[model samples]
Target chain A: MKEKIHIIKIGGSLIDDTELLDQFLDQFSGIKGKKILVHGGGKLATTLADKLGIEQKMVNGRRITDKDTLDIVSMVYAGSINKNIVAKLQQKKCKAIGFSGADANLIKAKKREHAEIDFGFVGDIEKKSINKKLISKLMKLELVPVFSAITHDKKGNLFNTNADTIASVIAQALSAKYDVELLYCFDKEGVLEDVDNPQSLIKTISEEEFSNLKNEGKLHKGILPKLENALSAVKNNVNKVFLIKETQLKNHIENHHEGTEIC
Target chain B: MKEKIHIIKIGGSLIDDTELLDQFLDQFSGIKGKKILVHGGGKLATTLADKLGIEQKMVNGRRITDKDTLDIVSMVYAGSINKNIVAKLQQKKCKAIGFSGADANLIKAKKREHAEIDFGFVGDIEKKSINKKLISKLMKLELVPVFSAITHDKKGNLFNTNADTIASVIAQALSAKYDVELLYCFDKEGVLEDVDNPQSLIKTISEEEFSNLKNEGKLHKGILPKLENALSAVKNNVNKVFLIKETQLKNHIENHHEGTEIC
Candidate 1:
């Protein structure tokens, strides 16, 4: 059987948790497979911007990346966040290469302009142009490719992309014979049915049910996009989509516990 | 008198020196002026890439930014390095806002394919479309702009730019009635008379002498580019250029330092 391809999306919240992040890294170091790690640094970016007195403006929870905001986001996401993960993985003896979308033209994208609201510096992946060959080369050498959601265009202009979405796209693109699993690892257990209750973890949710919950206002904003991204991955040929707590990796991988499993 | 505009380029080498970085931040915190900071992260970027077993190749000392390398560079320069500086400044009570080229469309550039060598993702300033208004607004709020040398195109694509060059460009652009002082801060005392001798700091050098030294092979690679950038700023109306040791900030500002003062 071909090596199992797992694309894990680690959110900024979980990445910032030193204890949890170290634990995840330890578990990841022992794992033997072709793995791709995509990460987000939203909290870090926003907090730094706020502390610097740079106004934080978001359109629908997503940062409205003007030139100034893009600068801050790039620094936080690609610089601090990416390196921290690489360093942690290295400490665990994992051969991991951290990168942004512009590297090797790994993920080419077009800046999405929606009506009057232009998502400045935001990129939608040029799915066909993604150089999966780069990932394949690295994976063959047993190296984990850690990616930040920053891409470039044909002309070599960079764009800030959504990490979860990028992971899904990458998983789909790299889908060969092995089952493609996308793990959206965040701080919480999984997609919670109640925002205030930690015990209200949804064990499983179908696409229809997820949409219904979203419409009914039961699904919170944080997990809604994650769910949509997970569904998109499933539709795009990923075998399974898992939303699990980052710290519960062993439980989820070995015992399959305490998270929403999406198909 | 209008607060003198100072453009300071803090290099990765100095940042690596913890003591120097801390000292510079403390000094910068007390400075009263409209200041813009441009930073380089070559050392950190290369270190991380090497640890990951990624063979780093450079064209003219600048990293040959392929897709993967660009990602690494973005992460190191914009993400990790940027935040560390901002955090340190914040710790010192300096209101510092970190930014990359994509923010506020502040710096726009065209990819230079000079002499058939495709300098992958490297950009030259567009000159016309720099978002001075956005910078002006930020300065009005007394927020010191810490810039990463990344640029965007008219179509919202990001590119890696030379921090020294970007600093020069920004200095010229932000110049009003007061002369813009461009200071390239690094670990070295200044441009040396002899590369082998640390004590041979050149106190002053004319444009012609600087060029002569380059031709004579006394100046090579990285420093050449930095000098070129400094000269470009001088030619473009920036008032002065100083190659000063980051640790000697107080002496340099007080006009008593042993640094290479270029005019």
Candidate 2:
């Protein structure tokens, strides 16, 4: 029997809020068994970018990362924010070791090659890129690995990557060794029938319903990628995937019944 | 017989230069057995601080780390510079993990309280604070641990620390399990007698000679702490300690005959 590993990913908004981050940390530290936490760059990165006077490269509402933006993200995401989380977790008595892709080549990525978009430093985490043995060793020592969404090419160029994609890929990679569950925690209760209503939580999202929602164009652009990532993880043998509200985190972890389950 | 661990400490000047850093990395990677690299922040931190208009707190010719200065140093030293070095080491096939003191509570520190000068966020690392087992586990996996001079108070405040002290403490802590040698790599070949002539390298310095140099005021302000750190490490049973030039790194590592040996 494979030991279970919980791979939880927290977005920027939750991390950026002090009270909520403390709540999340308390709840996360309570999780039993081997686990890993992946974190996104919060609004702090954008604020730093603004402070640095580095303009974003936008074409058709899509932001392309240039060298300057990459540096700012590296400093904010990999530096202060990441350290902040690690320190807080230590206070919570969780043995947490923070990581960037550049730190031990845990994840190596090549820059995205789309002729249409010059996303200078954005990298997609490659398949087989997760160093499973290193992670497993850390886990064996009862250490929880905390990761920032900053990866690098083996050639030493750091790249910004989507936190959700990083979570999904890591789930798929670790599924071979551990029974993995990937959780996407956010503000909404779950997949909502009425996007604006907090009470309209969809308990479970099936593949057919996901297809119908895609065809109906009811899924917002923001949720589309997350759903896609969740679906892909399920198909790739992840034991479970959950989209839950940040407030419902404790209940979901304790009850194991709330949140939208994707199958 | 105890296994050997090389704890090499590199100063700011060598890390600031691309060519010198590459040279150092190449030589350091060639070193066999369990090893760790402790690096100081280069000119980049000071440059970024100047650009952000964060003034240095200098009192009576002594630099104090105010809160703002601590944040900048943490960002530059632990974030970008540390990650950059880890990435390059990965390219060299050295599995390198970058760290700040907060990670895994590896080094717990107390804020410095001096009556004369208020060093705002400066921390003195506590005794027995080094997590030797965590480090030994990493070395057991053939991973090189690279550290920046940032430690936290466990209450979530990150403080600026000296890399030399970090190296000395880590070496002393690991000496029980491994024969440790602490190397302080900087600009000069060694401690120079003339201070102006590079060829006047003091190949070795004893406890008596060190006291003489100190009383004569021949020791510069910067090198004092490093030499003090080295002497303390020697007293604590570290097998060897050296102050060597960055350029002579390869020769020192391979031949084991260069650098200023302190006894």
Candidate 3:
């Protein structure tokens, strides 16, 4: 039997539309073998952070997660966002368990302290500590593992990791033979060649082409990270990545259309 | 002037009621000096676990936290519950930061694996590693620290710690002059001498009297650990403990009346 694994990256924007998320889960439920969900809670994290009076700072579209910001992000991503999705899935009759990087040392990370810039609580994964046995046990029970983009160091310090990167890492680690399809669901249809025009959605793009678009300022700041993440996933053995609109989730899954595919 | 600190335990039941939680926050805005919030999310955690098809178990009222359960609990406690409180506080114009034991190695712990029964992913606090510096830094910035009762082993593995115990530990470590109060707020009005009668609310009880009631089987299973925690806190320099209804929070803080005071 050819093992099938689908790694889906659900963006923070899609979380609000419960209907869309439900449709995505329903589609996921039909698929056989393992399915991993890597979710982004950037907008939700920021909303909660602002409500907590925690000042949020960003550099080049990435949140400069200080100690305070990291705390809020960890809580929103690993806590509320993870459980809410699990709850919704369970409501839809799908078994789903939420996890953070700290659980079973599933995602061990090393501190990435950039010398020139202070990236207070950022981490890079330590591959050896990734526990496949634990994941396999959960899969045998037919439970979907929902992950938050947070990792911990060997000394027990928690760090804020990029959701896209975390999803890519998990997909590669599982290595279930099927293409890891990362869905960076956003408000728009897909990556646009011209920001002002809706019809200019780039259906396909190579790494160089994406980089050129980035250099030309045609790609929006928010979409740049998603594109970078998509390319990284492909480079790291994830078969394909999709940048699609949230509303087009069902169509994208069923027909593999309505999004720009990066392979 | 003597340094003052307030240690408040916001019950899980209160958190479940969004309107009531907001009212509590409105009252909390009037509180002065440094404040620390220790929270519980057993109900939410169990709900998520059941939704995920994970069986929930308890031994002596403490959740039997296995690796998988620990993951879910961490998400609910440190992530969801902690962030919600912080966000609410922020909305009320208060500076709040959410934290677990993992960040800054705030609370160091050793695994408590006993001979008869193993408490998987459970830890006993190791005092030396408690990061008072982080708390002080936050305090200087006038940020309220919202804590989730999750600890980390020396090797960085996340463990489930009791919120009451964590509150007691922090209170003792800080050595603040203000009375440390553990408000074990629940659905009930207060701890009762007679379980059946609503009017049997025990107005006051010494440690010995509370133990006698327990021996007679009047003090029931649910309140045993709470009493143990309250007594432990009092013994460890926390000036006082209170078991109260969530509705009487403002009155309890202001007048120190309307609850069962344990000493």
Candidate 4:
């Protein structure tokens, strides 16, 4: 039997709230066994960009990561947010180390190619991109790696990668050596039948169901990418995958069914 | 005999110039054997702070790192500068990994305890503060560790640390396991007798000579802390210490005497 390792990803909303982040980390630190954290950039980057008067570049209504935006995201995600989370986890007695994908070449990415739109600095990654050997070695040393949504091409460029996809690919890569459980922690109570109703939770989501819901326009714009990433993880042989509430981490870890599991 | 390692420190001015920094990193990559790089925050932090209208807090001519300033430095130094350097080094085929003190609790620190002034997030570290064992393990993996001048209190706060002091203490800590040569690479041709003449470079300076130079008030203000840190490393068990020109890195490594040695 392989060792169990939980790969939990948190979105930006929780990180922007200091008190909530601390509480979440407190619970995260209490989890037993091996774990890795992946975090998204919060509103801080957008806020800083706005303050600096760096206009958001959009092509076909899709957000584009220009040089200035990439710089802002790199600083916010890989620097401020990543270090702060590591510090807080350290205080909770978790052996957390922070990283961008460029660190030790943990993850190498390629610039996203498009038909008509240039995504600027956006990167696309696959399971092969992850340096799983070194990651396992780090885990063997009992170190919890906290990763930021920043990746690099070996050709001297840092790109803005999606945090959800980062978590998924890492899980896919590491599943070869560990019993990897990937969790996507968000603001809601799993996939909701009604976005506002906590009681209307979907206990499990399959790829067909997800596609149907997405096609029916029942899913919100934000949860679309997350569910896609989650499905990708399940398809890639990740042991288990879930979409859970940020506040339900402890409960989910204990009862093993607090949120919607992806099958 | 212990295995050899070169611990090099670079200043902010070098980092501020992109072209010069790339050239220096190229030279750095050409060097043989185990090595580590510690870099200072360049003008970007101050530039960002100024743009954001965050006033520089000073007391008795010493800068204070308040909440706002700390946030900016953490973002610029640990995020933008460190990752960019790592990416560039990777491009040069150097296996570089970037870090802050908080990463893996690599260097735990204490808040600066001053009698009259509050330095806010400034942290002070010692020889014992370095996690040398883990660092050695990292070196064994053939990864070059690149550090940013950002540390944490372990109690949940990231602090602005002096990059020179960080290099000195790390060298001191690792000297027990490696034959360490600590180098401070900057713009000038080592310590100069006449600030304007590169030919006026002092070949070496002992403690007595350094004190005499200080008493004569001949040394410039900026080099004072750097010289002090270099001396401290020599006084500790660091095998050797030098202040060399940034451009002379390759020459110094080859010829082994291009800088002003500290005895």
- Each prediction's Cα lDDT score? 0.74, 0.88, 0.71, 0.95
RMSD of 2: 1.5
lDDT of 1 by residue, A1-263 (tens): 55677788887777777787878888777766677789887577776566556786777766677876776676667776775576556546675656666543567687886886767878887447567876686466555778887766645346788888898888888776457878988878888888678799888888888878888999877787788888887877788888988888767777755588886
TM-score of 1: 0.54
Best by TM-score: 4
Error of 2 at B230 (Å): 1.0
Interface root-mean-square deviation, candidate 3: 14.1
Order the candidate numbers by DockQ, best to worst: 4, 2, 1, 3
Top of the candidates by DockQ:
4
lDDT of 4 by residue, A1-263 (tens): 99999999998889999999999999999999999999998899999999999999999999999999999999999999999999999989999999999999999999999999999999999999999999988888889999999999999899999999999999999999899999999999999989999999999999999989988999988898999999999999999999999999999999999889999
Each candidate's interface RMSD (Å, one decimal) is 16.5, 1.0, 14.1, 0.5
In model 1, how many backbone clashes occur? 26
TM-score of candidate 4's A chain against the true A chain: 0.99
B191-248 in candidate 3: lDDT tens per residue?
9877677699999878899878988888888788777877776777777678887777
In the predicted model 2, the residue pairs found to clash are: none
Which 10-residue span in candidate 4 chain A carries the lowest summed lDDT? Answer: A134-143
The best-first sequence of candidates by TM-score reads: 4, 2, 3, 1
lDDT tens string, model 3, A1-263?
44666777777667767677777767665656677888887576676556556787877655577987876677668775665566555545555656666653567677786756667788876335456666666566566778878776545467788787787677666655444566676778788887777799999988889878878888887787778777876777766678887667667777867778886
When only the first chain is scored, the TM-scores of the models are 0.92, 0.97, 0.87, 0.99
